[model samples]
Target: MKLKTLASALIVSGIMSQTVAAAELEISVQNLTHGNQFTPILIAAHDGDSHLFQAGEMATPALQKMAEGGDIADLAAAVTGAGGVTSENPAGGLLFPGAHVDSIMLDTLTMTHLSVTAMLLPTNDAFVGLDAWEIPTEAGTYTLNLNAYDAGTEANDEIINGGGAAGTPGIPAAPGMDGGANGTGVMDGSSNDKVHIHPGVLGDTDPNGGASDLDSRIHRWLNPVARITVVVK
Candidate 1:
């Protein structure tokens, strides 16, 4: 009878521990750029072993597809397949500059880290990224500043052509429609083949014919293009 009682107590303890391990999080992402818009954002609560994109490393094909085309399907599938929780396109569509998407709820059962990603329009293979941030066990509000990363898969030609496919040589659709036209490409090749910090866009003054389609004064942005707030509950 004592053994039976001890076994039952152990089972109850295990269940209670499992419940304590789970966490609910309220996530909010804000676009801090002046002109650039973010494509559908992908937020993932995953284990420490998983990462959306790593600096100084070659980008995965899934990451390349997202950084180039603003497509998060592949990345979402990967996160879900790894037993992770994902919130895809929380903003419902393109997140314009100075806009914020709030109250995104994610139930992280066993995941220990968080990651975020989204393509920045009007640039070539540049995307906002947050890689493998440790989720604190203590409940509190945490803020993070995200930066723009160059996938290094394509050159920053600064063209406004609709070339979103991987290995393409131009920028995809510009949501603001503020981009110029009839501009020559910025560069023929990329200087780095691995993922790294973006050098930012190089726009010209001429709208009709210049070295780039982007406007240097309007489209250019410094680091920390996005801000993420996580509320641990």
Candidate 2:
């Protein structure tokens, strides 16, 4: 009887440990850009089928809102409505270049996948995105590098005109305060009207009056603009 009881207790303990490990997560993000800033980030944990935004697909209205502007309310609502768990704006505001937000606690509770999104400041409809990544069942730390994505809902004119509203024609804001004004616009060369890898910014040397309001030397960036760390505890 003693042996049987001990075996049962060990099994129960193992099950409890697995449950705890599956439900808790600690996440961190770093902006690995030269001069860009990330808007309020939205992190979500959901089932396998859900996605914040998929490449080669059209952008949803909620996603377009977040990409054009810095808004995440509609996207948060949609995630929660679909039975997903989310943590919004963990950094509390704009995540500047080389800045890192650490130890964001998220109780994922039965969710198996993770997704994160945030708009890149000083760019039109450009956002850093992580589509449904499978959460590891093993208890350990994992790191991921994310790329900038174009929502393809608006033109990349690179004009800073406070046009944050969806379907607007210009960039919402330049948090770095380095953007210029009073110039022509860069034409949207790509005909792809779907979410795709951003071709980076077409910033020019002129800060006062050029084809773009963004500065080529100050606002340019390569791929893998952000790095994410996940700890499954």
Candidate 3:
């Protein structure tokens, strides 16, 4: 009788351990830019079938708000409503270039995928995004490189006029304060009306009057603007 009781206890304990282990996940994000700053970032783990944003599709109102103004409240609420786990503004504020931010251990057993987004400062409607990455079941760390995406909700005016609201035509502010002033906008027309890879800022050398309000040499960047790592334990 004693032996049978011990075997049953061991089986129950093993089942509980597996349940606990499957619920927890760890995720980390890094701002890999050389000169740009990332505004408040939003990290979420949702159902594998759901996505925060998709390429070649119109930006959701929440995504547009976050991309244009660096606000993540709405996006957080949206993800929560869909039964997802979320960590909002993990950096508290701007994640400076080359800075790293880690999310608190997230128990996303039911949530099978992850998504992240943050606006890139000193540009109009440009954001770094990770959409619906499948979290592996094995215990290991996975790294991914992210690209800069244009929200396509506003023009790339590049004017730092403190206009961050949706539908505004100018950049909110240059967090680094490295942007120029008093110049014409970059492009009056955008070919893509949906979310797409950013064409990068078209900055000029002049600060007083030029085609762009950013310095060409200082603001330019190639693809893969951000990096993210997920550790499944």
Candidate 4:
């Protein structure tokens, strides 16, 4: 029994040691949307067993807050608690269209996986995500174009209200100020209760009265709304 206990302790020590090792990584994200804004981005490097958000799965409480509002506090704390390295809001504030933050350098020695998440403004619960992407060990720069995702935490009401908290009914704010007002709302409920690819938004030209507050011509985007470049140094 004593020998078995000793072996277990040694195994745990090995794991803890590996987790403290670091990998040098320079990371950045660019917003490709024409007019949309990305809330503070969260970039993390963790083990394969952890994930910030996963498609086809229900979002966690932390993720729900982020997707519904531009809140990264909870998610960042969660990642740090999970034995991972994280960079929050590298751009200092909203990452505007065509804008990028390239100064993030992560020494993710023990962490082998990478993920990024940030809420897209001018809509409810819409976010861009990269879930548990494996960080390549090879010394090269990797570029990935990411798609928008819905946290499935709120209905895409397309209304801009001051409700940014979790379980709120509307979008908190739209920095672009291009969205309309007096929107009746777009949907009564979310069709899917799991994180999934955003169906894109439906907006009308009317600003005074419309089904959605977002401007279709300005807010809509194709796949790959954000570009991520990771350099393994």
Q: Assess every candidate by TM-score.
A: 0.91, 0.91, 0.89, 0.91
Tens-place lDDT digits, model 2, residues 1-233: 99999999999999877753556899999999999999999999998899999999999999999999989999999999999999999999999999999999999987889999999999999999999998988889999999999999998998999999998889988999999898599987899889999999989999889899999999989999999999988
Task: List model 3 lDDT by residue over 5-122, tens digit each.
Answer: 9999999999876753455767778888878999998889898688889999999999999889988889999999999989888888999998998865788857878889999998
Task: Sort the candidates on lDDT, descending order.
Answer: 2, 1, 4, 3
Error of 2 at 135 (Å): 0.2
Error of 3 at 72 (Å): 0.8
Q: After superposition, which runs of candidate 4 have C-alpha atoms over 4 Å from their true positions?
A: 1-21
> Model 4's lDDT to the true fold?
0.90
Best by lDDT: 2
Least accurate stretch of 10 residues (summed lDDT) in model 2?
15-24
The parts of candidate 2 lying over 4 Å away from their true place are 1-21
Candidate 4, residues 1-233, lDDT tens digits: the string is 99999999999999888654567999989999988899999999998999999999999999999999889999999989988889988899999998999969988868989999999997788999999999886779999999999999898888888778999899898798887889898865657989999988888888888888878888888888999999988
Better of 2 and 4 by lDDT: 2
Output the worst ten-in-a-row residue range by lDDT, candidate 4.
14-23
Candidate 1 structure, TM-score to reference: 0.91
**Could you tell me the lDDT of residue 180 within candidate 4?**
84
Error of 4 at 229 (Å): 0.3
lDDT of 4 at 210: 82
